[model samples]
Target: MSSDDDPPESDPSPHVTAVVLAAGRGERLRSELPKPLYSVCGRAMASYVLHALANAGVSRAVVVVPPDGRGRLIEQRLREDAPDLNLCFAVQQEPRGTADAVLAAKGQVHTTQVLVVNGDLPLLSAEQIRPVLCHDHNDAVIATAQVDDPAEMGRIVRDSQGRLVATVEYRDADPAERAIREVNLGLYVFRSDFLWNALEQIVAQTRTGEAYATDAIPCAVRNQSAIAVEVELPDGRLNVETPADAANAEAVIRHRIIDRLLDSGAHIRDRNAVWIDAQASVDEGAVIEPGSHIRGNATIAQGSSIGPNAIIEASTVGRNCNLESCTVRGSVLHDNVEVGPYSTIRPGCTIDSHAHIGTHAELKEAHIGEHVQIGHFSYIGDAEIGARTNIGAGAITCNFDGQSKQRTIIGEDAFIGSDTMLIAPVRIGNRARTGAGAVVNKNVPDGGNAVGHPARLTPSRRAHSTTGDEL
Candidate 1:
């Protein structure tokens, strides 16, 4: 990636356009979601392929989808997920062959060279694609890999003098041919002119009625118009076609994420136990304990300590914050915040700096100010507490009033005794105090005290008027 100060590269370094084949319906997985939309580490499977293309300096891509509701859904989701890439969609009207899928994207790509890859390969990386994109005079550069058990994969055919020849699908290959260790990885970079001509002439298989992209190789070899090269990838294509395949890909992605964090100075207690998603960010000097699952786009800043059993999903944890065995979902914790074990912070909660939330506390849609203390066994939902407030143990914000939820406002420096209940739509003024087991339904004025069931306020230093009064 070029830095902001660096000048962009000029032309002559071929601009390669990409065509992602994602129209297939993976029946083996037994799920209603499209194969390309399958989630691998909380992201769509095809997103990795597009990201790889973007990393390889390909700015534009055409994704081929089936012509149905699934295709429309895939287009919508991918567009929303990948806003960085310039993505265009093409509809494959029929479930023809892979070659036909590329044909569907014919006019969409306007570049001399084109890259074709399967969208189900969640492990696709920029390193594997760079060489193919850089290969200059080849009519077609096909990526191949040597695998232990090349089950149902196409085997790359070579001539007597070890020259590149045809590629045979597994079903069509004989026993001796099937024994070849090297299999087609289904990734190819092709010259646009040669690709268009070859794809036009390729024939469909008799059994499947689908035209294979591999047929283009023989066309190139037979015509002898352009040079075809094979680039063997070190790691084979890790495509997810089944549930087991998805799990394996997820494990690899998880390991990569953790390893990256470890290399970048983050401390991970257990590599195997901690599962951090690809989009999650754990900065240097952060510590992730065992059994922690950081999901979605959560960010843990420097000096933060997360888990021993915590789950943080789509949340942000600021510097020096400590989260124990709890679940923080769609919330934000500012600097120096401390959440005790077993606390559940739901969506729309924002905890300010230096605040401490006690164990077994649940907060939802609450805005907690700086240095606030929420005691154990408290439920602060639909409430806003000002700075330096102390919420007593077993305190409840009775927000739900049978029909609708209401708000509770607690002012700064206020102290509520243990087992106090503040009913909804109530306000406790600054420096106010509530006695133990008080059930407060009306607003308490500043510096006033409430001490009984259906609590009535005692005389205070300040007074409140019936009408709107400026004190």
Candidate 2:
């Protein structure tokens, strides 16, 4: 029979159900969060795997997560992040073997064949995944890797005819099996019925109290089923478990993102100085100075200038924003905002048009409106400054108490002097003024002025607030 006339060897509807095993606690990662939820290049580590599977024609998926609050959170996040992909969740109530995890999603596996992928392999791609699933075999077709050191991995034992016989674990393998360089990479494609039968046989072996997927391979081989090994591309298999592995995965992802950006018409003056992600966009006229790293879905609009030494991540910079020698992340800047030689714009900041963030200034979760000026050596966090406001040198909004956070609001056309400190949950109204070395703890009404450590109000001024407030 022709490939199409035969029973569906692979998913023909561009819809294969993927079983992603993410039930492990990943204790070696040493994080409170699950390893799959950890980031790689800008996205969750598991997201890359999901994307690859989706691209490889898996329309639906059942991610097997641990029975914990973290796992539920991961499922929710994946749903929100990749809404286009039809994804479901399956709970592995206990720490079981990989085969048990797959069986947890047995109800969801309706396709003729199922694609099983490891959650930790962040570098795997659709091109590599598709070929393994396309193999026409009555038995399981596993993606295998030829590693230099196969000491820890399960050995892929093949017969003289080069048909895969079994996968022997390192501890159980004989010397002859130990010499094989081909190792099971934990990615596989199996005929649905054969897989179900193998899993049933594996569960019957629970007398040992530990059920393993590798055990199923031997069962299939005993039944005279064909087990084949599909060699994977060298660059496709990277398993992240420990911190060192995470670091290596990060480097690999970084290189991939950089290469993709370069191919997409992004200019890097010095490869060492610049780190741009695959998803970030930089116009041709935009100049990314040396020692600048733009990461995590950030975009530098046309005519924008990034630092001689700056880092920007998970943020958006509009046209002509002068970001020189600063670190910005999870912030948004409108057009023509000037961030200076030494500044840190932390997460949740929104700097409006013509705002000036000067040298040594640090802002976190603050909103600086149009034409606002935040001068040197100031710290503004959890604050909202209105249009045409002026924040002087050495001024700080004390946002964090010993226990919690607070907010500071400066109204339109407000002028705050040097060495001023605004404590939490405070407000300065429109056109308010503060004298030099003022410590503001209370709200100042519009067209008012204040001075001293515990700031007091001054007489109203009809004239508009100018100078330090203007861009």
Total clashing pairs for each candidate: 0, 1
Query: For residues 266-342, what per-residue lDDT tens digits would candidate 2 score against the true structure?
Result: 55677665666545667656777888888866888877889888998879899888999999999999999999988
Top-lDDT candidate index: 1
lDDT of 1: 0.83
Full-model lDDT, candidate 2: 0.77
List residue ranges in candidate 2 displaced over 4 A. 1-15, 27-33, 80-83, 222-229, 273-297, 398-408, 422-432, 439-471
Q: Write the per-residue lDDT of candidate 1 for residues 131-211, one digit (tens) a residue.
A: 777665677787777788788888887878766777888899999989997787778888889888888777433366688
Query: What is the TM-score of candidate 1?
Result: 0.91
Best of the candidates, TM-score: 1
* Poorest lDDT segment (10 consecutive residues) of candidate 2: 1-10
